[model samples]
Target: MLSSSGRGPSLVRSAILLAIAALVATFFTAPAAQAADGQISGLAGKCVDVAGASNANGTPVQLYDCNGSGAQRWSNPGDGTLRALGKCLDVSGNSTADGALVHLWDCTGAANQRWLVSGANDIVNPQANKCLDVQNRSSANGARLQIWTCTGQSNQKWNAPASGGGGNPQPGGFVVSEAQFNQMFPGRNSFYSYSGLTAALSAYPAFANTGSDTVKRQEAAAFLANVSHETGGLVHVVEQNTANYPHYCDTSQSYGCPAGQAAYYGRGPIQLSWNFNYKAAGDALGINLLNNPWLVQNDAAVAWKTGLWYWNTQNGPGTMTPHNAMVNQAGFGQTIRSINGSLECDGRNPAQVQSRINNYQRFTQILGTTPGGNLYC
Candidate 1:
């Protein structure tokens, strides 16, 4: 377990690798679903095609609807090779560069077509050491499919059937299809670290969904990262008090408040504070917030749930335009600014804020893109 403050560039890389390893282990721990019936849930409506058009080596393959045709009927072949329509799904010529095109070719026992199936949403190709990437790493539909280096991006994840199909059921019991799962959980790893962050999305219905919305996994992970960085991983604390409480502090009336009226604000996960937020969490969880504002820190699950409530309520990173914010750091520096400006009612040090901005910029650079823009706190 690495602390956020201690996570330098090298540590971040290690964390990413550790996350990948955890996902791989989880994938193997789950049993493979029966594909003998050819009844795949997610791929039923998607297209498939033969690689390379030649059914030979180095030919480009395309995706087309399944018509019981040999070209569309694929087999895992239990040898890391996908055999379908007498061809294999491959990375064109085994190239590992970014933006590499995927093609169909004859199966020669190469590693490109050999995939490790996790749930319905994630797949692993060992040869190129990457996952099948969705263009632009977006969650929108109709995005093109390609291969890219795996950095646990949401676009590369695919979900397979749970071993015994006994996990919690999503909104619908229908299991997410492999292709659809990949769309939701696209990347090399599927698990995210849960520590001090108030919003741990690991338990979100969106990430656990076995159907359509499961592709929002990356969004969930991003939310967790944003909140973790914002709140000092449960270290920083806030103060809580109700306006109606007897002897409450009011500058116009009294300078000294009653002992019971002033209480420590809830800490950790969602930073639960104010009567409104407590009430919201209470309503959502069917608890009485007025009686127990401390539930946030005392209950881990409740804390995380409150955090998700904020994330969902706010449009998240998508709320504002990237250009207006500059560098599009989203929840990172912007959140700190918000806290300091509104809550602290104190000016934040420009140097400290800029340092955080630099950290976020470096993070995005490692992932290979300039994130949209910064959310100016």
Candidate 2:
């Protein structure tokens, strides 16, 4: 090599070639995939918005209805920071609490600025083991942003725009974040032990991919609204009445109650009761629920699936599935009619239907969709 570093023509040429190779390597080995610029939807169907559309450091990050404005746009540059308005989402003074404010600061690659965008739709700050939450789960405009324990509330659900965000006008996939479910039913942990609820719903393509974006949200909201009423916000995994525990069994059925006469009591999200319902739900879910009614209470995915099955299928006392009732514009009333119309519809019990209607209305508002007319059966 003509004495390494001595200024020979061959040595100079080789050095230039090595430098070019290094440059080429650097060019080819680019950073990780860049997160697409879009809005991140959080509590109350609001987007993680930039206050006043300001790009300056220390700008407040709050929840606002997604309006496609540049202020609401965000990016994850594969560098552990969620960037918006060219600023990193930073935790104020690196605090970890139920209400530590989140704001924009210059990108510093700090641990407090890093986040783990989980499959459950939670923007978790691993440094604190907390989530990016809309303070107090408020749905109103100008709600403050904070870092709180990952409670799986709707306020902590950060749906990226590309995934059919929580409030964007564009069509998005149907997804129920654990956080949203937690917000709707704060008492779930006491009864439900199942995890991966979002993943469970994702397995059923029809659940999230149904109808347009509005319809999808309506469907999900309606389902959850009715379910909230059915299970008291999923606080009760099974019916509470001990007397009715044995009443669900129908001894006349061909298969009978394999899970015992008392085993077929109300269980799962929709309170799937009776021997026939257990058998049918079991057949649909590929599990022997007729012989194992306890599965619904013991398995979270099975429990939610049972509820969804009933929502998508059985009309109960109504004329169509609850899913069809919402998508076909039959209104929320039809869903009540489909579920328990015999008891609650046709002026039999206005209060019950009204309760369901109230839930639907409130849930729809939270989801940012209008609950259509005929809210009563």
Task: Please identify model 2 stretches exceeding 4 Å from their true place.
Answer: 1-173, 193-196
**Model 1, residue 35: what's the lDDT?**
36
TM-score of predicted structure 1: 0.34
lDDT of 2 by residue, 1-377 (tens): 10112111111101111000000000000112222357777665678888898888778889888797888887655555677778988889877554789998998877678665554566666454456778767888888899765444577766663322222121233444556656666666555543635545522334433345676677777888887777776677777777767666668779987778888777767777777777776775567898888888888877877776666545565566676676666788887877776666788878878888888877777777778777888
Model 2: how far is 319 from its true place, Å? 0.5
lDDT of 1 by residue, 1-377 (tens): 11121211111100111111011101111224443333222332343445333566655544344355555455554444555556766777666455667767766665455554443344555343345666675443334456654434455554332333322222322132344333422331222223322133322222222112322232333343344344543334332323323322222323222223433244444454434445444554455654576666565655665665444332222222111112122444344332232221134355545544554444344333443443345
Error of 1 at 13 (Å): 39
Predicted structure with the largest lDDT when compared to the true one: 2
Quote each prediction's TM-score.
0.34, 0.53
The per-residue C-alpha lDDT of model 2 at residue 268 equals 67
